[model samples]
Target: MTPIFRRLLLVVFACGLPLMAVRAADPAPPPPAFQEGKEYGKLTTPMPPMVAGKPEVIEFFSYNCPHCHDLEPTAQEWLKRKPNDVQFIRVPVSFNPSWEVTSRAYYVAESLGVLEKMHRPLFEAIHRDKRSLASEDEVAALFVENGVDEAAFRKAYKSFQTETQMRRANQLVQRYGVRGVPMLVVNGQYDVRSPRMFEVVDFLLAR
Candidate 1:
């Protein structure tokens, strides 16, 4: 063979070796159960009061949760790919009294029909923008600046509806036995938490 042709074949084989190995290799097996605890379920299913027919992907997260903020895109992409098949729900938990601001802020965003608009920005307010979204006034200002009418936001922030939603959040947290933010409950039954969180979900979905 010509020198150039021989060199080209060598380069092609080198590039294809890894691809061939990958295709020939068996995938890694799932990890053994470890994070499984008292409330954890095996082959679990979501609870009722759930919207029927739609599979639910509930994210139990707080605005102050840096991990949740980081995973937002992956979670968002998951939702987008299955919009019609899955119902995505965000449950904000108060890791402390200080985190209560996050719960209020979430509903306030929902009320304004801006969860999509403010979700990441709210995360940024704490993680990136270095802003305090810890108060109704501050959050309201954010809404106003973002073109959500301040008066409307203020009214909703103080609204009984928002308060009711907050109470509901507490109840759901208790029901799911969720102790941390950014935990995902698939169909309200199986909770994905700690080390294997996303991995567990991938396993559950694969099944």
Candidate 2:
């Protein structure tokens, strides 16, 4: 090889070595810390805790909401790691008649003791399968197909207990002033707005 060409190759390699070393030594940027009005917001008036002596975290969501469907997996992961002292609750928001139908269906699943089995599938049924759960018959059929007794499903769907839970859910929605689905309210005082919702909730729980 020519002397000039060999020298040039060595010079380039020498320069690249330090550059690569610097890149390898650089630390990753830290995650964003929770901030008021950005990561989360303080409620105008904090609501009373649903579970006494335990911090409460409520997720306001709608079954028909595509965003809520998207967040289900991440939420489930967070639930698995969340503090046992914290009481986590899911409140289905009914912004309209159709959503109210789904909200009632949620309570029916809860009442029939099928929520653990039905939750993810229900989200999939609406969002993944693109099926219609907009009516009582459709909701009942889905539950029955998933191993619930058809008679019991219908009974709970119309029973006073489910109706009471639905009313309470609506009350919490109004009190929280929730206008969007997939919202996380921490300790009834902070409404988490950031995409890194669980991190903010962890911060609030620590505080």
- Residues 1-207, model 1: lDDT tens digits: 999988877887878763234555787888654445632354334476378876777788888888888888777666655647667788899878768977888898898898888777788889998888777778877777777888888888889999999999999888877876778877656776555565566555545
User: Which residue ranges in model 2 land beyond 4 Å of their true spot?
Assistant: 1-32
Most TM-score-accurate candidate: 2
The TM-score obtained by model 2 is 0.83
Where does candidate 2 have its weakest 10-residue lDDT segment? Answer: 16-25
What value does the lDDT take at residue 79 in candidate 2? 94
Off-target runs (Cα >4 Å) in candidate 1 are: 1-46, 194-199
Candidate 1 positional error at 50, Å:
0.9
| lDDT of the structure predicted as candidate 1 | 0.76
